[model samples]
Each structure stands twice: as C-alpha cells, then as structure tokens.
Target: MSATPATPGTPDLPALPVLQADCSNCFALCCVALPFAKSSDFAVNKAAGTPCKNLQQDFRCGIHTRLRDKGFQGCTVFDCFGAGQQVSQVTFGGQDWRGHPGTAGAMYEVFPVMRQLHELLFYVSEALALPAAAPVHADLRRALAETTEWTAADADALTTLDVGALRGRINTLLLRASELARAKAPARKKNHRGADLMGARLAGADLRGAGFRGAYLIAADLSGADLRLADLIGADLRDTDLRGADLRDAIFLTQAQLNAARGDAKTKIPPTLARPAHWSA
Candidate 1:
C-alpha cells in the first residue's frame, strides 16, 4: 500500500489511504525481499533477497496482467503494505538499487521492516475511523501518529526497530478498540479466535462480534455472511467465498486478503477496501 510517499509536502492535500501501494513509483522490492516456495499460488521457488525472473529491468512485473494464468497468483494477492514505494522512493530517495549496488543490500533488509510498520498503520487507521471504537480512538490516533512517523526513518534505523515489541504495544490498544466496536453488535454467535475453520460452511452466519483473530478460513463458504463489526485481524481468507457477504464494518480486513479470495459484485465491503480485480463480474 505504498503511493509515492504522498510527494512530501503537496498543497491542498487530500487524505491518503492508510497504506496504498502505488507501484508506479516502486522498484519491485517485493520481487526481491520476499521469499516464496513453489506452490499452487506461485509459479516458482524464489529465495529471499533474490530477484524474480519475471521482474523487468524497469522494476515492473513482466507478466503483470497474466500473473494468475502464469501460476504466479500469489504475487497477485501479496501486498507489501506500502513498503515497496516507501523503501524505494522515501527511504532510498527514489534510487534503484540495480544501478547502485551499495544500496541493494540495505533496501532488501529494510523492506519487510517497513512492511510491518505499514501494516500497523493500516489497522490503526481503520480503528480510528470506527465510530464504535471512539472510546479508544485517541489512543489509536497516537499510535497511528507514532507509526506513521516511523515510516520516514532511514534504513539503519528501521533495521534496528523493535517491530515485534511495537506490535505488542499497539495490539493492546487494537484489542480494546475491537472490543468497543464489536460490543455495538450484540448478535454474535461464536468466538473463534485462532480457530481453524478452513473449508467450513459459514454462509449467512450470524458472525457479528465474532473474534476471528488469526482464523484460517481458507476455501470456507462464507457467502452472504453477516460480518458487521467482527474483528477479523490476521484472518486467512484465501479463496473464501465472500459473494454477498456484508463486511462493511468488519475490523482489520485488508485488500491483500480480499485479493486472495473469491467474491462477486453482490459482496458488501468497506469503502476502504476495493473489490479485487480478479473477482467475478
């Protein structure tokens, strides 16, 4: 979710999405820093810090439009959480590591670090916008401010950041915010925190207020599910059927997760999330 670093100081500034990945300015950092095993989702095995074969000289995916057809579907669903452009344009000053070998190592090392920070930014921003989470909004705002500022840090500073510790600190506030938001919807039927609901049939379920943190719902039938205010932090929704599902107020749902799933025009999603391009028309 990186978008050219917002151009530093533009006038008449518009609100930026919590983490928008603007690949127009990215240097294909994800193609290098991330590792992927050959699988049904990815076409080949690639080690971390190694460039992908399909990465073009200009840092764009050579087969961008045919990713799924070429067996690189995982690339289609993976989001760097804006780390790519932040690392390429901001942290490294719009320099391509290919031409400058000195910066290549640092760029790869710092990418995943920025990814973690931006992910926290995403959740913090979402929590701040929830009216039901107003009680913890100020705390979330502070966390968002702190995390947003951290994104501008240099590669060395980012590498040394205690990301796990920061995530722990922020998770406390996010947990409280989730509690306040879910309390508004009293029709919850389950608390499936870290549940393995893979392939389960949950279509049209009364899932309001369900705690789905870390749930593995791969290929689950969740069509038309009532997911309002459900805290879905870290839920794996790959290939899950979300057609007609109402997730307008579902906390922590991300574009990457949505991109990995199946849906249709009938799905009710948050304004913050765009329908994945691959979803059926």
Candidate 2:
C-alpha cells in the first residue's frame, strides 16, 4: 500500500493511530538517543546521544522523503510509539532542546526511556484488542495504563529509572499474553513434534488442539489458519506469516519467538508480542 498524506487533525490514517511518527512535537529524540551502525539500512554510523547530521532545525529528518533510498531503512522502520509527542508536549511542556540547551543532555536521556515505556504500552494495547485473550485482558490493561502513566512523567523521574529492569518485567507480562492469545486457536488432534515445516502453506487450516512442540516453521505461511489450543513449545518460527491466524489458547509462545516472526495488523498475536511499530500500509 502507498503511504497517504496525513491530514492535519485527522484522526484516521493508514498507519496505526497509536504508532504515528510525530517529529514536529519532538526534539529529534531518536536521532540523538539511539545508535545506528553503518549498514544498508543506515547511511553512516551514529553514536548514542549524538544528533544525526540530517536532523533539521525543526527536529525533522532532512531527507525524510528519501530516507529509504538514502540507506536509512532502519530509520524508516523505527517507531517511537508516540513517545516523541508525549515527552515533548507533556513531560517537557513543549520545550525544545534548543530553547533550553542546558537540558539537552537530560532530554536525550529521557527520550530513550520514554520510548521503552511507549513500546510496552504498544504491546499492551495490541493485546487488549484481541477478543481471544480475555483470560489475561485485565492484567494487560493494568500494565498498559501503568506504562502510559510512566510516559507522561517528568524528564527527571524518567531519567533515573532502571529501564532494563522495567523492560524485563514488562516482557514477562507479554509472554503470558502470547500464551493466552494462542490458546484461542482450535485444539490440534495430534502432536507434530519437531517437524520441519518451513515454507509450508497452511492458510485457513484447522490445527486446533495440535501439539507443535519444537517444530521448525521457518518461512511457513500460516495466514488465516486456526491454531487454537495448540502446544507450540520451542518452535523455530522465523519469518512465518501469521496474518489472520487465530492463535487463541496456544501454549509456550515467547516474545522472542514472535519477534522473529513476520506479521501485520491482520495477524493476531499474544499481547506479549508487541506489534512492530514500524509496520505500515
């Protein structure tokens, strides 16, 4: 799908509402707070806390329209989950890093922290959207609310947080959410342990209550498949397309595993598997 121009003040757009990349209300936070290695995805190596040379006076990407062509595919894929806006508008009260140069370093520190919290909220919100994860919806909702509150905190409070530890706790909750979402799929009748099913097409197939323990499913197309109540312990799920698959009640699905899997809006994952913020139409 082609990218659509965002109408000012229009709530609906092709991209996820919660995942919009708002640079206007930001301090070029991602450019400064995140490090990028020299690769096909980025033009050059940039250290953390250093602003990208391409950042404009207004905190916008100078080559925004040609980021991908300019070897900035990584930048195109990074999403702040609205953290940029929340920090710029709420936490710092619309203050720019330039206006208060003294706070520049501190603002840079807070940006990454806010990004982490916002990313957690993104996953929690996705989990709540699945009707099949009702068993753990309450926990997911509470986590989402708490993470949202953290994103709105003052820069000082956010700068001092043990972000890694907080991320670990949030990851645990997301792991539980994935299990709940997968459990909703229909139960498989038989076990398929350690099967190599790479690139196998199983769209709209019913594998309910089936045991898929330690299966090699690399590049498998399982779109629109019903995987309810299946046991998926230790499965190699890299590059699997899960769009439209019903994974409610699936067991042993981990965040790392889902992270390795490819999915889109139509692909329903456990709340623990936060939607990749960079995904767009």
Which one is best on lDDT?
1
lDDT of 1 by residue, 93-188 (tens): 988889998999999999898998889988877776667777776666667767877888888999899999999999999988888778888795
* Backbone clash numbers for all candidates listed: 7, 23
TM-score of 1: 0.92
lDDT of each: 0.85, 0.69
Error of 1 at 258 (Å): 1.0
User: In model 1, what is the error at residue 181, expressed in angstroms?
Assistant: 0.3
True lDDT of residue 28, candidate 2: 80
Q: Deviation in angstroms for 229 in model 2? A: 11
Off by over 4 Å in 2: 1-19, 187-281
